[model samples]
Target: MANRATGVPAPQLLFDGSEEKFDLWETRFLSCLHILKLKETILREPDEASDEDRWKNADCYAELVRLIDDKSLSLIRHEAADDGRKGLRILKEHYSGKSKPRIINMYTSLTKLRMADSETVTDYLLRAENIITALREAGETMSDGLIVAMTLSGLPDSFKPLAVHVTQNEDSVTFAGFKRRLRVYEESEKMKMTEPTTDNVMKTYTRQGGGHSKPHSNRKEEDANITCYKCGIKGHKARKCYKKVWCNYCKNNTHAESLCKKKGGQDGVRKVAEEQGGDQDHLFKAKYVKSDRPPGNVKMKGIMVDAGATSHIVNDINKFQSFDNSFQSETHSVELADGNKCSGIAQQRGTAVIHLLDNAGRQHTAQLRDTLYMPSYPHDIFSVASM
Candidate 1:
């Protein structure tokens, strides 16, 4: 079959100087070069290609060799570097390691594979897998059970219920079982976040008897729609109405909603007092409105708050401390204030808790329900509404 990439597929194994994956880097790099049929030329030196036909192949390899990074490039030095086999061996000898520091670093990362508050189990496992793979390559021995136990211990406290059950139950506690159960939990929780909720309108009672009153019923809401004859809303009598008496001018609580915005005045100046007319007569009831944009911020536990935003945004989804699998229903697009549009994009929603310390030194925690994880977002925008 033809290659999946219609045109050209970008290189995946270009070395970016991350020494931790040198073993992986070398294997993938060589394999990719070989697949392109350029490996023979790059790996074989001109001198080794004795004939005219061999020299042409060697020349092609030499040209592609420049695609390699500077660090590895230096290993292909003057005479010794000319030959592909010798150069590959030299690159391996220098870059590859049984080095104490590399192994120690890998072990340290494995030891600290924590499932952060914002991180999902799957992402945490992938991180752990990478660390475990590195350790294994370093000749470190780790049993599957021990690795599973480590993974379980790293999950957040919210997962404690399942974590405890898995650990305590002998029959359903294998690595595979844990992975399956964890994914199931993740799917269920995500569903709760995206599902439409009906309890938007809550009944409020007057001063003293609010808590003891019966909850609003669907029958009354459906029949009367709780048209507050007082506030023009349904469900409650005038005494129990909670709609605010608003002012259009001077924007203050002192204004009344019934007074005309252009006409409220002592000296022809509008000073809206709280509208007592809310109990006078019902004009028209306002229906609950759902906005097109998902209004709250998804809290990011470790991110600094950006208070000037209308909704939450992260620079990169991967930069998110934790991420769930793709959760948006449609391709979400964003239009900037400048009238530029970003179209057909994928966004993930994240949940996080933010900690705040008031001026008086009292600490409070706020939970963000759904944060937009936009990989192309240029900056973090923390929303006050979400906060």
Candidate 2:
């Protein structure tokens, strides 16, 4: 795909001249060559390569030259551009641990390695493996036992149990075996935390000073007593109601397009909000509203009108005229089209300025009441349904 900013095909690999990341960069470079069916051409010797292969190798060599930094390219500039194999060998030899200082640095880094809190086990292992690979290529020996010990030593305190389990096991633990057992242990621990407990139910009965309590009904029995809003039937809520009463106008399942109150305009905002699950009485929805083209002075591109949006949302705090910082609690959140909730502790609601331009190019400003302020919101949305 073309890059959005540059309108050019983005480079597949971008190497920042660092010896630590060279191995990964080389692997990706070779993989790209393989995909283009030019890996064989690059690998073949100049003497053995056919006339057609020589032409293909030029493209492969160009890709190599494009990916590497200027400093790395200068090392192999004397090598023929048509001979990718020889140029790549020269680049590899230069990067693959020729310096004594670099080897010592790598060894020092390996010893001082400690997993960060934000890093996952797999990511930490990959980092350790990269250093080990670099050490081996530098002619330094690395044993599997030493590799396991180094890997285990770098893990954070949370992974101590897994380390202990690996060490105390009857069978010797390879790095591969430890990874497998770690996956299983992590999943099992998650299951233990998430699984529901009857301890709360038992505690409820043990509470003091309460009269003889009636037995709680089972979930199925409770659902049977509840009425569904969608179909006016017992046993389920509107969300679970099987009856499909579709309103094509509002795209709601509760009613038909022909019977849609929203078609009448502002009168249906409250009714539509109720159906859409917005509990806030002051929820804004744009049913029908006239707006003129905003002149260049106003940032018309920054403002977006969402027809399906249940509330007006503003990203910038400066847009608010008179704000209510405590308007909404932390638990109150706005739902997105993708079924994800957007919430922040700093979220506020109040009157906001809405800039507009008339047909005569006269600038006008209107007050947008009950507009939500989400500092982390991606866009300033004017809800058509909340008008």
Candidate 3:
């Protein structure tokens, strides 16, 4: 091989190969390359840069630089005016249609904004306190959740006193750590106020005579105070007297009978006869029998009737069955005193008559005008003859 050397390509010349011109062009090209390389390095770095560092980067500052370069600053001024009008409209709508929940959400959002460094905590607290005060003056009761939220948003303990009476014991835990300790003392005071005392427990049993005497238990004492009419004593009723008097209806002192002259005397005898006549003259008079035994007997002296009752009733149905065997009618039901019903016979009275003799041996007849039914008498019998 021959000893020949390869040559390098010459640099493309700019501005006609004068020394000053070439030097100036070379400097400009190298500076442009350096600026591009710096931009690439800044873009490749993580966004963990501080605000000042980000502002210093030429690529990030390019928008401001372009705004300064362009003579269209009036466009920026017009956009700012439009944004202000939009903000005013939003504020008006927010204030006009806001509900309690919306207000609370707005307050929470503001608190969060302040926490994130978009607003001052003191300003947020002042605005929130004004809202809470207005709500209290409007007679609205705030919940524990709202109070806790306010406290967490940097509201002071001075606002705590405003809600003291409204707060419940269970809601005390929702407050800040220092406020909860004060709430424990408040609860203790409430407990002391509600506790029962010994004086109140004994007040009910201290009345005048009620403590010494109960009603049924003091019956003997009550009887001892009753005045006796016969013997003229203070300790006994008239029926319990020891002295005895002559029979008012008889001449004898031992007993009184129907024929006794003392009973048939001028004044007493006439009075008795007139009373008996008045009893017999009543349109409806019946005898009611009373006994203190089971399967009791009741003797009916007159016709037993109830014109006011809806159904016919005759006591002692078995007694009338022997007298008129064919007097039986359809068996109907009647209610007894114990709430059970009894089956009985209903009969038509075609001139049903009852006869009875008075104490003077004078006979009287009682007439019936309607149907009568007889059921078994439970314990009492009412009769018209007794009148």
Candidate 4:
């Protein structure tokens, strides 16, 4: 654009090629000459040059730049003895990193970008943005739309819904705007995880007697007739109900009040210390397995191999072919990672014999010891940690 007052174009910034960045500098110098319409004069034949003063003006501008940029002056002192254009060309050939391996590395980095499973959207966006910036500096032109699409596509599978939301938006997404949306989506997902779900509310009510308890077939007909005093639900006896006898001591439900590791409150729904199966003097931590799945009956198909568990567990007590029902009225609970405990569990005193085939197709028999049984458990957990 020409200057309105002087009818001459505004001067362009001079480059000294600091940090060995000659590609960018060279482009700027060439663009300045083009903008001033002096590039044709410098490229003209000797006869054409004689017809115009463009070549002379281009040379004068280059020399002025060389003088103003101290770094350029020292590098071109010998090369540009007569014409500044020669000095500029040599400077570009010497310092331009176009042929360097860094350009390939930058492209590789951009292509390999990924969002880790544990990485938050905010952190991943920063990582992708840095890669995009490096690619741009290496002369790669990535549009904001491409960046938005790539970032959304590179996100972990859990963000598929967010990706859909982005694609479904009517408004064009700026890179900055997409980041804000990503952050909002991240927060929403976090809230969803923390908030109580419908199933959780249903379970809580079912356990508290506000909802009907699923009947256990082994429970006595008389016991199942009336509501349980412990859980305030109809279907099972107080002894059979899985409602946890909250323990005041140890701050967990791992044991009933009577079986608490420490002294507990007396006014709650649990039996007194002396009323529990064992003598008060013998109260101790029971052996049971803490599993992720709830109770159900599915035979061998339900078995789970879990290294995180300290013991093997089965959800259905009846599935145990040789289960010892010695502690029929006794309630044993398993401790969870969240510090809560579930009461529908028991430590088995018997063994289970498994008949299987090895890789050689030969039949093999294995016996498991002290397997746990939880009448309410859904999956059979075989703990490698225990083995």
- In order of listing, the candidates' clash counts read 22, 8, 3, 7
Provide the TM-score for each candidate, comma-separated: 0.41, 0.44, 0.17, 0.30
lDDT per residue as tens, model 3, 7-114: 321233122323113234334433433444433333355457555444434332332222221222233334333232222233223333246775565455435532
Clashing pairs in 3: 249-263, 302-384, 302-385
Number of the top-ranking candidate, with TM-score as the measure:
2
Q: Report the lDDT tens digits of candidate 2 across residue range 1-387.
A: 235798543454766778788898888888878877988777766666577877887887787777888888888777756567777888888788558988888889898899888876667778887998889888898776677777788877877767865664546667677767766776776787899853221111111245553333364554455444334455654434556565666555443344454464322432433342311112222221124324444334235556656567876677788986656557776655433343552378888886665557665776777788865443467766557
- Give the candidate order by descending TM-score: 2, 1, 4, 3
CA lDDT of every candidate: 0.53, 0.63, 0.38, 0.54
Which tens-of-lDDT digit does each residue in 22-48 have in candidate 1?
A: 667767766766776666665555554
Model 4, range 1-387, lDDT digits (tens) per residue? 336797454444455545333444555656666776656544443543352364464564454354336766776666566454566555655554445576676566666778888788877887776667656655777888888877776788888767866784557899998899889988988998999652221011112245643423432543334443344455544434577656465444443545442353322323332232121112112223223335453222324455446556765444455865664424656654223556644545455554444446565555566677653333356666556
Candidate numbers, best lDDT first, in rank order: 2, 4, 1, 3
Best by lDDT: 2
- Poorly placed runs, candidate 4 (over 4 Å): 1-16, 19-35, 39-54, 57-69, 81-85, 101-387
